[model samples]
Target: MLIHPEEILETINMVTHEHLDIRTVTMGINLRGCSHPDVATFNENIYSRIMRCAENLVRTTEDIQSLYGIPIINKRISVTPIAIVAESCQVDDYCSVAETLDRAAQQAGIDFIGGFSALVQKGMTPGDLKLINSIPQALATTKKVCSSVNVATTKAGINMDAVAMMGHIIKQTAELTRDRAGIGCAKLVIFANAPDDNPFMAGAFHGIGEPDCVINVGVSGPGVVNSAVRALQNPSLGDISECIKKTAFKITRMGEMVGKEVARRLNAQFGVLDLSLAPTPAVGDSVAAILEAMGLESCGTHGTTAALALLNDAVKKGGAMASSSVGGLSGAFIPVSEDEGMIRAVQRGSLSLDKLEAMTCVCSVGLDMIAVPGDTSPATISAIIADEMAIGMINKKTTAVRIIPAPGTKVGDMVEFGGLLGTAPVMPVHNFSSETFIARGGRIPAPIQSLTN
Candidate 1:
């Protein structure tokens, strides 16, 4: 993991001008040992264990940032899913668990703490149900805590019951946090085929198969990729793809260096380097802009999907070549609110909900950071999750939905969530009803592709 000084010097301009940086350095801490029968004891065990493990995470990241002269945007922690860790506790409500995690994260000086989660892809246990029921309150009460629920998987198919419940849970979370334009929903994600080593927030959790302590990194370089593409004058499609692959290789190498240094300092195992092109609100640093640079007039146009597929494949191939430990959702991300270019596309009516859904088939994650109207029905939201879940289940890829039913907002209105969360223009969903469709709560069997064995 030791990089040469010349290699460090080579990335000076990319760091100084092109917005290439380690998006997140997440420490995964297994909390299975913290489980206890008493609720108070369980909380105490988790809080003490997390504090002991992650007390120096922020400072270590800061030291690495100063030593390497590379910006690390976020230092985060992912614990074993609370549904599994807290099942032994006697408590019915998990809001206290969420608050404990939030306090520990604040005390440790980290950005966010994930693992307020449940895995109910096949069927819900009593503990899973308890954790799921507490999500609305947990997210509403905790600022730095993030939650996710995996309601479907490639092997287990789609769980329509959990899907239906999550729709209602999302609505309730929005209502509880209406003052902030339902920002609580922004911290919640519904997933299908969630990865074990993802470092990004709102969908990150330490999986059961992971080590007791591990370090994972997420790298983003949309601006660098865009610059590479724009540097080529009247290039063919093959030329653009090659340029992206080279740029992605450089970006992933930098990320691996950062991740390994952080792991070494913290005395933790280096897990994986996620080379997802996660964009921000900043101008010129957008995945959508990269697509547009490939000759698309707008992001969600006719040829947009084909362009995105090329970008996604090239990024994966290049990143895989750069690092042997590449994992997570290592592809392009199409989060609407987080990308300024995506916001502009939606504002110009060039991007619609249907188009975004179509693009998710090739993208890293699915239906990310999209805002819909307050009056949208839970059934419609469930239908949306179902569609995204089906895509993941059939394709055997990780997909997720992080949609916000912004309270009191309609189409064309903007809900501003400053700093990384960014602003979202309310996109319109279909007006048709899906009540009966959602009401038939049963498992959608796994696709034929799942029979790989």
Candidate 2:
């Protein structure tokens, strides 16, 4: 990849003005080898392995950031799901392991470490149940550990039992951290069809098939894409899509270069370049702004989904052309709290829980960073997860929910989770109950499309 002077200048402009940056460079470490029959030994093994593998992760990323003058917002690590690695241990509680992970991450100067996770898309093992049970305590105690559970997949159908369990778990997590406005739940996510190479947080994990250690990069440039769309005047929808595609191509190329360099310096394999238009709370750097620039008065209005569909599709197409290693959730993200435009839309009544759910059908992820009334029932949360899972299962795409039921907060109330998590307004759910539906806890069979394989 030869760099021309003009291309360099354009990239600098994007970084300096448009908020283009590598969102995260996650180091995935396989912890399958760290399992042991003794819980104490198991903890020691994982702690030692992480310290050895990621000893220089932070320094290496910092060096690269300085060299290229590109912002790398987070340096993280993803390990094999704890349920798989800790199943061999005798102890039932995995909170101890979560603490060990937190220590390793902090000592190594990492921002966050993912893979405190379990994959129960089909069914839960005894170990999975144990880890799931420990999530509330683990998250409430740890500062940098993130947990995710995959309760449904296109091949395995929906595990309604796990879905129901997570509702209660999330509630417990919130109550335990009520002083912080349920910030712990912000670090936990429930997913359907979770990806192995995702570098983003609250939902990233190292899959069974991944290498021992690899570097995966998540590139975010919603501002650049928004600029491209707004630059076109009196253009057709096709023209808007073409502009997004071209912008995505440049972003992907830059991301791949940075990822490969980071991997090379650390002596790790370069995994994938995720071209997700992840947004921050900053103005002019939002996915919702991109949609509004396409001529909509506000996000979540009619034709919002269609605009999102165009954006997601064009992003994927352009990213695919730029690199064979385009993986993870490579499309536009619509986390309401994280995007300033989305926050405004919610406050102004242009966005709602139902509208966000519908938008998830075409976006990369589902119903992310949402806040609901503290009194919302656990069964209702399960039903919300079930609904998002169904969309991902049917479409064979990745969808997740990171909702906060802030204690003592109601609709129209604001919950502040500063930094990358951002603040969210409490959104309303349906008046009717989904308790009866969620109470019938069993696996929802896979769709007919699963028969293809």
Candidate 3:
């Protein structure tokens, strides 16, 4: 853990000048004990269990932050998917449970609460169906609630029905809260082979196999990485690998320290340290900046994929060197609104949805922060999700889509979600129809690699 004086100066400069800080250090708490056959009993069990499990999360996180002097930007909780506990309840009962969970998060002083989720990678259970149906209302009515749906997997392929339903649900969710439709989308994520113990949102949840309680840290420093790249920008330089390598090393060290301290304070096992360079609306804290530093004027350009590929690789290598356990989507993110560089790129017409999709092949997630016509057909959105999931299934990498269809807004209109969720200018989609392709409601067959002789 010894850092040289020069390296320390560089790190300090990165943090002070750039917007470098740990995005979140989430503690995952399994809530299986909250299950009960009786609806009322189950509801009570859920509130009590979450309250007991997460009661110390905020305090423990604060203590660790004080001891380490490194900012743990978010003290968060992820629990077992509510769908699992609401099996016996009606749809209305599920919404009630969401309200209770939201209240518990507020009471516990947490900014966000995750795991209002359903896993329908293969097929939807009755409870799963009910929960999915209630997501729009639940999300609109409740504050601080996040939701995720896993509709695809490497072995099972994509569930078109579930995908289609989610498309309509996302639109309905937006319609229910037109002013904050994008906020619901910001809180919602659709995944292929989603992980249970991911400390990143809005997809994080305590996996069933994990212990009852454990601490996981998601350390972000896109600003740090971008600074290193900027230092190497001599205008005459050809390759930027060295800058990426060095920056990743420092970023991983920060993650390692934060993860260990949080785990120690909680008296829980230290889970993976996710070295994701997540961004905020603040200046200089951008994945797009890292890309621009690599000589691309904008992130969605042809060179963007090459830039992200190197960044993603260097991050994994450096994080792996710093910690034995490094998981989560430990790569760069290109969310349009969250990063100022990305927003400008979109405004200038330098970034497009198609180019963003290309970047996602090498980056962390897919089509994040993208906006389309408010009246865009549900089937079209489903097609987009299916296309992204198909990439993850074939490549066997974790990829997700978080798209917002701003209600009553058309292309070129801006929709603001406020706070860290930020504002996104509506982007255009292809007017060309994909109705026939999307309407063919069947699963995309598993990738060829799935067959084992």
Candidate 4:
């Protein structure tokens, strides 16, 4: 069978003109067998396993990119969460493990290596606590290692104590990398209902249940959707939704095709295709721009949330039609630093922390890439996260917090992380304290909505 000419041309236009591309092709490797009684042997085994599994990853992806002429932006790896795998070891910290992972990633030409993480939705074990404590040092020392902590899930409810601790951890991470405007915080994500097979970094982890090895693809194209929305002549909201759905279908088709090709080449199981409208720092490629094209005065205006909900639902519908293997945080991301339109909106007073939180209720993830004041208290940060986690629990959806306390930076200051992470303006937070409420360390019971059984 031959490729359809019209479809081929359409894809070319999407890539060469509209900025559609495969955001990441991540290899998920199970490292359970690498665990050993001796920490040194354990580290060696871990490194060797990763290198063996992903040795050809970068070269294979490059070959596929040339073969298909699609831009595969990042080649990454997600391993089994280090906490569980390293639990038997007597080491006090996982910093050495993080270094080994970083070295392995560099050798394999991986852009980011995820799974330095812990799951403490209900409570923290010794391993979990150690991993959490070591995160600041681990992340601070490594270049490519990404970290995440899941402190809440829908059924088990929010872990307020862990939430409180992460606030301090985030601050410490920021301080550790303060010379770079706390860019380390950008690599750390705290989650409620975080997915296992996500291809995106700062949150990607090969779940304990996932296969030994698999390839997951992240497809991104906020620009294409923006163009499609703007192409409609005086379109209504319904028209815009249909347009977005159609665009998402096309983008996802490109993703599924690329992912299959890459998996076939790499001899790996094809995992999910994450169709998130993840924006870059580039001018035209922005999720917030797509929102603006949908007749929003600004990204955080009254109808912005409704418009986002529609866009998100329509994108999901379209992507589902294109592929059955859709997973991860597959929705439009509203990260302030990552999207130029979002940054502009914040700079112009059209968006704020409250409005972003409101928007997250209807989308995937929460308060991503938002920069708060330097002096923002850890209790306050924890309170912000508690509110977000509650939303996820009640709605039975995934939500994450990746806010940065830009050290020595206050409101109206701009933090430059550069490249794909972009830059963020320090947005104002509510001065009122949530101190006492956050200090009351206890689990918030799962909402009735979580009782789907």
Candidate 5:
């Protein structure tokens, strides 16, 4: 894992000028072993387990960052999905468990802790129902806890019942934290065909198949990609794509090297490297800017989906060449709020809900970090989610939605979340009712694509 002297300088340039950084070095801890029927006992075991496992996570990440002169932006933890672990406990509310996770994350000095979640792609169990009900209070009260629910899978099909419930849950979560601009909704996601080893927030959780403990890395370099694109002078489409691939190869190599070092220091198994060019609020560090750099007038304008398809495919191909193990949501994330270019596009009236939905077909996550009107009906939200889930289920790709129904907000108003969450402009939803469609609560059978031998 020796980096050449010249490669070190290139890495330095990527960090200093292009904002290249390791987005997260997430440690996944399985809590299945700690499950207990008693709520209080389960809470104690959960807290102690996380604290003991991730006590040195922050310090170790800092040491590695200083050693490599690379900025590691977030140190995080993703545990086994809470719904599964809490199923044994006879609890009416899983809010206490969420509090335990928050406290453990705070004690360990991690930025965020994921896995206050359930998978109801087929149907809901008593514990899954309880955890879903607790999401509103859990997100509102916890400082750094994140929740996700998988309501659809390619094999199990679309769970209309779960999808319908999530719409109400999302709105309630937003309403509960309306004072903070409905920030709670930013920490919750609904997914279809969700990946198990994702290290990104709002959708990250250690799957049942994962080992007891592991280290997963999420690498980000939107700015680097932007810079690479900018350096090109009137290049053709094929030339530009090749340039992106080379840049991605180098970025993924650095991520793999850093991930191995972190896993070794923590005595944990190295899992996967997520090569998602996740955008930020910063000017140059945006996925939309990269798209614009490819000659698009705006991110949501015509040809945006085709451009995203190219970028997503190139990054995956290049990263695959650099690392033996690459998984998770490995693509460009086009979250409107998180990406400055996308926010500008929305503000200018070029990006609409429909166009964003179209882009999600090729992007990382669906309807991510979007803000809708407070008056938006729960059934409409469910319908929106159903559309997105159907896309993923049919295509056999991961798709997720994290929409914020900011209370008392309209299409033009802006809600500033600051930091990484950024500010969101409330976008208008279609004024049509889909109540009847959502009321048909049952499983939408799996797509024919799922019958792969």
Candidate 6:
């Protein structure tokens, strides 16, 4: 299947308001074999295996970009959860492992490394506890390292202990590097039903069932959708739906071509095309821009909800029609640091944590790229996670929180993660405490909507 020159140009015209393309195509690698009782050997094996598996990732990605003429913005690696492998090691070993992974990514010329994580929703084991405790220093001292803590799942419910722990960890991470606390948050994600083969960071990790090597494509085009919506001078639901369908179809076609080519180069099987509407710092290439096109004065206003609902539905409809294998969180993202529109909204005092959550009800993820006060308590952060998870559980959609508690920073402070992840101004959180409710710590039963015939 080839995209004709004329067709490609038309799609380009609709999408490229500026120079933003798909941001990343991450490959998740499982490293269970890297575990060894001997700490020194364990570190060596982990680094060597990752280097061997990902050595050609960057080169292969470069070749595909040249061939397709579509800029593949990021080349990243996600490994198996480190906590599982570090079970036999001491607490200090977490830093060594993290440093090794960070160096490997840097050596390989990759931008980010994910799966420095622990899955403690059910409960924490010795290794899980150690890894969790090491997060603050592990994050502060390393470059290119991303972390995640999965504290809830549909089957297991939420782990209040883990949730509370992560809240404190976030604070510690911020305090360690108050200047870059928001940057640390950009590398961390809190998840529910987090996918194993996700090719996006700060949440990607190799699942247990994934093959030894495989290629997955994450295709984004908020610019395209925004342009389509902008062209509809006087729009109705039908008109808006049609525009989204067409734009998603074109974007998926690009993803399909890229995925096949990358798989061919790496000698690996091609996986799903993630039709996620990921945004960037470029002008007009933003999820917030799409909202503005829907007639909102700015993002985070009352009209933002209706605008996001329309944009989300349209993207899904279009993507579903383009590819039968649509997976991942294939919807619009409103990461504050990453998107220029979102950054501007935060700076303008237009967007808040609550408004961000409201938008997540319709968009892809929840409470993404938000920065709060450094002194915010762990229970409060857990409360934030609980609130976001409630949306996912009730709506039966995947939602997550990636909040940054910049240490020593308060409302109105700004922190930069740099590069594609971008910069963000700290936003305020609700001052009230949710300790009593969060301390209750039990499974929130499945919503009534989840029950069927």
What tens-digit string does per-residue lDDT give for candidate 3 at 1-453? Answer: 787998777666766787666778787877787777777777688778778777888887788777755677887888888888678664454788888889889988888888899988888999899889989888888888888999898888888888888889888887887876556777889998787668888888777788887888888887777777787647443346656666777777887787787777667788878888888888878888888988887777778888788888877777777777788788787788788888888888889888888888887877787778888888888888988998888887778988988877887787787877777889987787777877787788788866755
Clashes (backbone N, CA, C under 3 Å), per candidate, total 0, 0, 0, 0, 0, 2
Clashing pairs in 5: none
Go through the candidates in order and give each one's C-alpha lDDT. Answer: 0.95, 0.94, 0.81, 0.92, 0.93, 0.80
lDDT per residue for candidate 1 within 277-334, as digits (tens), equals 9998989899999999999999999999999999999999999999999999999999
List TM-scores for all candidates, in order. 0.98, 0.98, 0.95, 0.98, 0.98, 0.93
Off by over 4 Å in 5: 1-8
| Model 2 / residue 70 / CA error / Å | 0.7
The parts of candidate 4 lying over 4 Å away from their true place are: 1-6
- Native-to-model Cα distance after best TM-score fit, residue 62 in candidate 2, in Å: 1.0
**What is the lDDT, from 0 to 100, of the residue 233 in candidate 3?**
40
Relative to the true structure, candidate 1 has a C-alpha RMSD (angstroms) of 1.7
Of 4 and 5, the candidate ahead on lDDT is 5
| Local distance difference test, candidate 3 | 0.81
Query: Residue pairs in steric clash, candidate 6?
Result: 15-224, 174-407
The Cα error of candidate 5 at residue 380, in Å, is 0.8
lDDT of 4 at 55: 97
Question: Candidate 5 residues 51-104, lDDT tens each?
Answer: 888898899999999998889999999999999999999879999999999999
Task: Give per-residue lDDT, candidate 1, residue 136.
Answer: 93
Name every residue pair that clashes in candidate 4.
none
